[model samples]
Target chain A: MAAALTRRRFLGCGGVLLVGACTGGTGPAAPTSSAPPPPPDPLLALLEEREGLLAAYEATGTAHPDLIGRVQPLQSQTAEHVTALRLALALPTATSTSSAGSSSTPASKGGSTSGPAVPADPAAALAELRSAVQASGSAAESVCVSTTAERAPLVGSLAAASACHALMLS
Target chain B: MDPTDALQEALAAEHAVIWGYGVVGAAAADNILDRVRAAEQVHRARRSDTAARLHEAGAAPVEPEAAYELPFDVVDPPTALQLAVELESGCAAAWRYVLGQTDDAELRGVALAALTACAVQATRWRRTAGISPATVAFPGQ
Candidate 1:
């Protein structure tokens, strides 16, 4: 899996060749000795979105321990998504502790302090989680449509998986 | 593969799924027969839509086989539910392959919807069958 992820990143960087866009005269001047920064990857937003969803799962699980049986499996699946997206972006894997969900820690690179607070009622909490999953699935579907063919399968699968997760939550 | 080729593959899977669902509906208990019938109807619609899309693209849509070989004997509700999961999983894979074959946004949208439907239906069947962790991390991978 790690090897495949590295290969995808290598191919993506080599194939797209965004240098022309980066080097266009409209951009700020770069030092001649250094390479310009690569354009922001679209997948980065998706990766962060997955992380946020994972945090929501963790928050719900922690707040309502009785719902753990129902929440744990989905949370684990969401964690897998986080891992997959990270690998796809060629980002270093998060330490187990970080992903295990310390609420004080930011859920994503955007630096949100924590996931949305869980409702006191378990049923309501599940409903909230379902809404989040549905929204996430929509976001993933949009990304799947817009991303390169090489990346579409992964994103599309994530969108599908989120649909299933939403059903499970319901 | 060409986009049309991928669509043909998806159409073929939908054909097999429609055939497989007949066995599913037959073996499923009366309590769940409605669900089985609904699933079959969805596959039939998908098969028709896929075939039409292929025809529009000027490619021949593959026809369904007269009889499909079942992976196992689906003689009871348990086995029927299992077959349902298998059918959707196969369709999901086919549609996922289509996503990789086309850059057309419209085609990708259609493929994604099909894949998502398969994943959701698969989860429903798994849940009904008492499968733990009913949702997979990657639906079509």
Candidate 2:
């Protein structure tokens, strides 16, 4: 949980890069400096988190076929979230990458891998999902506090959805 | 875009929701009436507080409509629950707009709480309506 909170802290503090509209400049651009720009925007990071969640849903569903009926809809909704986030960020949707190459990691740990390992046990998989949803929701709310007003509601809704998902999983 | 504008909109939504719940409770079975009453009370309190906030800010909050257009006929328990879901969803959307209009932590906190409550209420109503998943990717998108 601490790690997850830290990830949220990173997202909230590093959100200025997401919109890139705050640059005040009436004069010519300054000479390029050696200093690197801020790391990738946390909005992108949240999108990647959603991607990982989609993978988790798919993997868990595949591992437990009996749960497919309940899992497919969630997978579809998570896909929609990723699409919406991508559109909000003005990024083109990319084709699915290599899931096989991805590794299982909790969202709080910030693993770039897409695949999140699901426990073979159905109950345990649900537990994992609850935790992930809670963490992702927290991350979304953190981003909400820093983004533009137009975009904050988008993230806020994501957080609410995450909370709802956690309830369903429970 | 001002907070008052959003607050007024939220107050309007709360009014509609409180009015809608009256019809909803009438159509709901005995077991569901408790839930309806609870929801109505919550919205009513919220409406009062919102109006107070608006008045404090020197903005005149809009009055509730004499009646709101029902999305559908509330003829049974299922329909009542569905109406409840719609009403809460409306509240969620309105509060979300409020969130977009303010950066003040106190106001933001209020908006966030209201939005979250409405979303959760929608989920509960969906469950009562026998909707699977009972949740959405976005509540007010």
Candidate 3:
């Protein structure tokens, strides 16, 4: 829908805000920034988006029980991801460079610790989930799935799950 | 499939879900209207977050057109659920494609989230339509 596309366009305007390392020192943009040049670190963006995903899930209601059950545990993992990123970001030592020539710093030290916990209102939860699912599915990057060996089945499993969701709704 | 590539495919599927829900949600009854709205929000949120992630990753996220072609006609909630089921299934496939290509532990977590969401949607649709949800996990797999 026109309204839907516009919503993203509105958000895109904030792309500039997602810049720079936590340190004041000058450097390339963060890896999460849309700019073609690799940013200082991608872990920050991952943390922000992970929160968004959890928020959406909390909004989803009972319409998607299967989805909620499956993802509830992973929500905790995403929180852990934020913690790991923050730790990585705080490391006094420099990180090794990826083969792609990109730097591999961890997430900013201030990443969130909140998991996607909420009251058990299946309907409300499903609504939240619908949003989270969209956000999660729409994200298309390799920051986390860096190696080729671990990538394929992850994508396949995601796809199959999506297909299964479609069949039930249809 | 590459991680970015997989995410793109899943994004496309999300695009379709967002598009199709208009008709399906509209037709759903009052009892389930809230559910319909929630699903719509899911699609919207997903679309936005996905695009942001895409941009963050330096990939231009595909813009959903002003309109999208639906897989089938939506006449009622049952029909809507039917369409939703189909859409969810397609989304599952797209996410699966992402699962296939992704390896990074973090990205893998995202792919798993996607997988779980789609499967839940599919199961919901099946129950809505009085269809059986197969006990075996990841039916296509």
For this target, which candidate reaches the highest lDDT against the unseen true structure?
Answer: 1
DockQ of each: 0.78, 0.55, 0.18
Q: Which segments of model 1 are wrong by more than 4 Å?
A: A1-30, A33-39, A97-115
lDDT of 1 by residue, A1-170 (tens): 47756877998565444543456655534343256557677777677676777778778888999999998998888888878888988877764634534422333335543546889999999999998888888889999998899999999999999899999988
Give the least accurate 10-residue stretch of model 1 chain A, judged by summed lDDT: A100-109
Best by DockQ: 1
Model 3 residue A126 distance off true place after TM-score fit, in angstroms = 24
Where does candidate 2 stray beyond 4 Å? A1-31, A97-114
Model 2: per-residue Cα lDDT at residue B70 = 97
Model 2 lDDT per residue over B1-141, tens place: 468888989999999999999999889989888888998999999999999999999998899999889998899888988899999999999999988998776787688778888998899889888898788888876
What DockQ does model 1 achieve?
0.78
lDDT of each: 0.85, 0.81, 0.56
* Candidate 1 vs candidate 2, DockQ winner: 1
The numbered model that scores best in TM-score is 1
Candidate 1 lDDT by residue in tens digits, B1-141: 369888888999999999898899888989999998888899899888999998888888898899999999999999999999999999999999999999999999999999999999999999999999899999988
Q: Which pairs clash inside model 1?
A: none
The reply for model 3, stretches above 4 Å from the true place, is A1-170, B134-141
